[model samples]
Target: MTAVETPELDAALAAAEARCARQGATLTPLRRQVLRLVLEAGQPVGAYTLLERLKERRGPAAPPTVYRALDFLLEQGLIHRLERLNAFLPCIGPEEEPCGHGCGHDHPHQFLICTRCGATAEIADHDVAHALTAAADRLGFRPSRATVEVEGICARCA
Candidate 1:
């Protein structure tokens, strides 16, 4: 199936290419292949699944290679680590735009994840951000990063 080309993905790919060039990392063909798979999948993809795709493309590959690529991608902020699912999905936001840290984005996005199908949708609403900040202020909890992921059945699944 053909993959949907969102504006976010286009921007992300361009940003990643620029970042790799600046860092002197080639973002080698294999790494690019794997990354494309993750991006095209449109859901959190497990390491083993990545390995399988890699093997299909290049004959044979070790698990460590896939893991290492994933690590590098995560480190570079090309993707985000989904803690709950223990899988990787491409970052849908602007490239090199830092969130959940000292980055200066007014509203960080939250993920609406579908447990059944692994579909993830981004929610970026001001009301939610305001409420979260207000609640955190009450508790005196300073949030460095604001990531609000709600995991449950999506409309289709429900």
Candidate 2:
């Protein structure tokens, strides 16, 4: 993976650390590093891809180590797993409000995935969420969570 060091990443890291502290979760060095990799990727990145990147920097990193870090990130809501792609994307850290990208730590996760370029964008649509909830409630079903993924060509590709 290409290296990324930017003010945005630094700010994100700081916010993530602060958020973890507030939640009583320890964002250890390894976990922080993993989060950095995810954020730098700027797209859905698979676990194995992350592992390879780690290996390039750390000499040798076991799969379990990477997996554990990923689990911690997910639990802390610092990153999200794209189920369809089996990949991960960093959460829009608390530094930004109103969930401009729809991947805020507390916002609903809906993704528009570009099948051609593999780019993905998170979107927030309250109407869609409300409609889905209403439809489910009519059937007496209560959903603990929901993720919507739409695959198509992105505007850039089009």
- State which candidate has the highest lDDT: 2
What's each prediction's TM-score?
Answer: 0.68, 0.90
Question: After aligning candidate 1 to the native by TM-score, how far in Å is the CA of 157 from where it should be?
Answer: 3.2
List model 2 lDDT by residue over 1-158, tens digit each.
12235887787788778767877989899999898989889789999999999888777899999999999888777777889999998775435521344344566678899999998888777788898999999999999888899999999899
State how far residue 117 of model 2 sits from its true place (Å). 0.5
- State each candidate's clash count: 1, 0
Deviation (Å) of 148 in candidate 1:
3.3
In angstroms, the error of model 1 at 78 is: 1.3
- Cα miss at 105, model 2 (Å)? 3.7
Model 1 Cα shift for residue 118 (angstroms): 2.3
Model 2's alpha-carbon lDDT is: 0.81
Which regions of candidate 1 deviate over 4 angstroms? 5-14, 92-107, 124-146
